[model samples]
Target: MGEKSEANSVAPSARGSLHEHHHHHITPLKEKKFRWRVTDEHSPPEIYNWTLYLSVFVFGILGSARGYDEGNISGTVAQTSFIKEFGLKSASLTATQQANLKSNITSMVQLGSIGGCILAMYTVDRFGRIRTLQGVCVLWIIAAIIQCTSHSVGQLYAGRLIEGFAIGQTTTIGPTYLSEVAPKAIRGLCGCIFAGAVYFGIMLAYFANYGTALHVVGRNQWVIPTTIKCVLAFLILVGSTIVCVESPRWYMKIGNPEMAAKNLSKIRNLPVDHPYILSEIADINEQVNLEKHETEGTTIISMIKEIVMTKSIRYPFFAIAFMAQVLGQWSGANAITIYSPQLMSLVGITGVKSLEMTAVLGVVKFVSAYLAAFFLIDFLGRRRSLYIGISIQLITILYFAIFLTVVPQAAEKGAVLTHSQDMAGKAALAALFLSGTGWTMGFNSIQYLLGSELFPLRIRSFAQSLVMVIHFANQYGNSKALPKMLLAMNNFGAFYFFVGVMAISLCWVYFFIPEVSGRSLESIEEIFSLPWYVIGRRGAELCPDHSEVNRVSYNVEGTGNAHGGDIDYETKPTAEFVENASNEGLMKSDSQSLEK
Candidate 1:
């Protein structure tokens, strides 16, 4: 007893002496260097400053480039003058010829996008996001050059393929970069920027095409519109390469804490010693170390296996890309965006007016998407936002269905049709604009952010690739189907088909998806464990205080002296288990459907 007492007494003194010696050795410079104190228990930085938002905004702008590439082609292709210059006159051309030409163009682009999405998954982690984006942009420039100079339809298709590949890479990678870099509080808003930028790009494309189509540039005028888009894309590509900062999380992944700290400080614009910054950096490091493999290389086989075999990851793998591609394509969005001018012309509006209204629709999409970013997503959370937007989408589609089926036709019996047949076109346009707003407001923002978050670090690339493949499948369908749909069913039949799909998708979300707003990236793993009902009902526990849960919720049993609050013994479920219970119905239905 005496010896133990003496040892205990000496331990404090020794510790104190060591502490004092360490204190003495820490110079002012060294103090500044290792100033930010963080442990696993703490949360990351909450407050965002102007500089951080500005830096992220630049990323948003770069994302807009993808949108520009997508939107430009649709509007430019519609102008009659462009058709004439491209020798698309029906009097001289067969229906077979037009179908073949459009199918060839759409197919090539979709295929290229598939390649880009898959390639980016592997290359992004190795070369870093910025460099990969730079490569895509360079390809865009080269493709644009080819497109502008195309003497034959085959060359145009080839150029589109290359452009599609670049777009595919940018669209997939940009959101991944944005979500990782953004703080949780504003992540949804930052996420919306990609959608907004895309709509804005489309709007810009429409406006540019409209102006160029009207330009007095002598003989062949299609050259100018394509040229302008290529120039803009090239400029953004170059600008982003020089100015964009590497994602702080990415820096941490590469085993460089100093650079990570420096970048974090720049991103947050907080002092280097900020508690939140330190916490985030530590969390990222912990995650990377915990997840990284023994080998440095991320192999293709491992990537595929991680997605398919892992129970925790497969759901998100299917969900996000499915949502993006379906909503972007099947939910009538791609068909609408690509054929807005034609839809308008069919309704009653045509020529300059149809083009102008298409531009207006693009603006509406931009504004609504930005508003979704600013308020709805962060405030209401992902599932609620999705519900609200999708509900509105359903309602809009219903309106189109009713109008299409019941509304009187424009051609009065056998009267000579002097003007463009417009009643159907107008109704379709109204429905499209309304549905688009809903699409952007909910699904567009959530899919990319949610998809990126759902997969584990090991499976992220494969999952993204798989989802994108699904997405392009829908894109290919919509692109090929639109003209045929328009020709066969007319506006009403085409609009109703998408309406039915939206209704089906809405049910999918209501039954299966868990709300995931304000949750940390790591916590997303829990999605697989909770019962789907529990997830849908409880939503995710967001921004929980990460301090000692025991201290916070201690149970006092059969004791006079009590400490803390009584705690429930119930343990949280894992993601895999949760998904199984939640998805039992879905699994059965899918099996039955497959059998049928």
Candidate 2:
């Protein structure tokens, strides 16, 4: 009877405390509805607004610009007219000169990208995400104009370098911006749209190149396709300037909490103090405070030390960030993306047929990327999707190597294939297509998504800049080395090398990468704070309870103790308290009551 009375007393007080908490923010009439909505985990998707779609669309267009730039060289280099006009096809030039030309044209952009990314790291924080995007868009337009009117190889190189710089900056900023603005429920889907845009851009380039090769004459063939990139860049500039909202998280981080609440409300299509908006704002503010504490006097040296010396910060996340770039680059996908026409020719696909085949490959990649964005990423989860995709890539690359090795005509320079050799070449082409699918499904989308999620807010931009630097360095090396390597080692040796890299990547994903699906960005930090063993096991598990985090926030803010005079309605019994209650034979009833 005493226990029952105690329970009744506690219940009323708890209810009253919770009521007071709501009354602080909400009118009584709306409190009941707000409580129900905020507590429900599976609320329907937020209403789609033009501002939301426009933000994603602008980012997508920037991705398409990147795709167009990457795919343009593949088909352009293969054109007889392009080579003839540039003195590249002349017997007067040494093989080394020709290879150097190809490498420079492709690699200059990557070098530029590295520079642009470094600049973006500072600019994104200073000028804001929207302005940074707009500045790059203008730079890309000027670079495009230079390329479209180039009178010499030097001019082309200059244009590509500038364009590459712009692409690099956009690549870093676009996905990060999208991730920040998107609602957690559909964040994965929105993040992957950037990947989808990349593939779509690639497809546009391929088809444009194919049409030019078939119908256009002389330099116009290359000129028309190159100009298309400028159009995409222009669209992004306009969209960003006119339609995009500043990231609410950015506003919060910059000491504008009122503006942050306003922007978030606008994005969410809710009142400024709606429970969902309030909860999100609270999560953002708490995370910012935690990061500030973690890196008290933030500096380059201190940030580096924190990442390298802090076990919780380093192990899975820092390591994963580095590996994400390595896997994305060394997975052999970029080699195919930039050199597809050349690779197809090595497999005995020549002339217009090879260009068409490259277009088909682009289509396959586009479809796979879209599928990953819409269906695979959130549904299969990050780790499983990566494993499945890497497995397919490994199989396809091995098959490609085997086919090249067995068919001497495919590997031998200037050798025409026999009937059987032709069939083998076609089979290798099929493997190449499948490899694109696997890569898009696994590495392409996930790398960008993971890069955004892996770090705390305080150092996320710098950490991502570091990742992009390595990413472009790898791309630059591959673009510079791939053409020469293909000729020197035969296509078979190159595939074998990629196979070895992919094998290493597979092992890294299995042991190191954790599942992060369905967890809020703030919750991810808590997951990493667990003992390494438990983190490895349940890092991806949904954390339905927020009381622990609430307690941490209160304590960090120097608020009163959990059991003090003013009740925190958000607090719940700790594990120790629950265990003690179990010992006293009150566990079942107390647990049920607490849950209710």
Highest-TM-score candidate? 2
Against the true structure, what is each candidate's TM-score?
0.79, 0.83
Stretches > 4 Å off in candidate 2: 1-44, 47-50, 293-297, 411-420, 530-537, 542-596
Error of 2 at 589 (Å): 33
Off by over 4 Å in 1: 1-47, 217-220, 293-298, 407-428, 539-596
Which ten-residue region of model 1 has the weakest summed lDDT?
579-588
Deviation in angstroms for 439 in model 2?
0.3
lDDT of each: 0.61, 0.73
Which ten-residue region of model 2 has the weakest summed lDDT? 578-587
If candidate 1 were superposed on the true structure by all CA atoms, what would the RMSD be? 13.1
Report the lDDT tens digits of candidate 2 across residue range 1-596: 23323433444444444444422221122232112212223221232466777887787567776788888888988888888877776798788889888888878889999998888788888888888888998899899999889868899899999998898887778778888887655567778888788889889999999999999998898999999877887888888888888888887677676677678767767555233454466667667655655667677788778778877568644568778787778878988999998888777777888789989999999999988877777767788778888888989999999997888576445787778777777788899999999998888878778777667678777777767877888899988988888879976898899899889988777767777765566666656666665554566663343522132222212232222224332222222111111222121223432454
- Global lDDT of model 2: 0.73
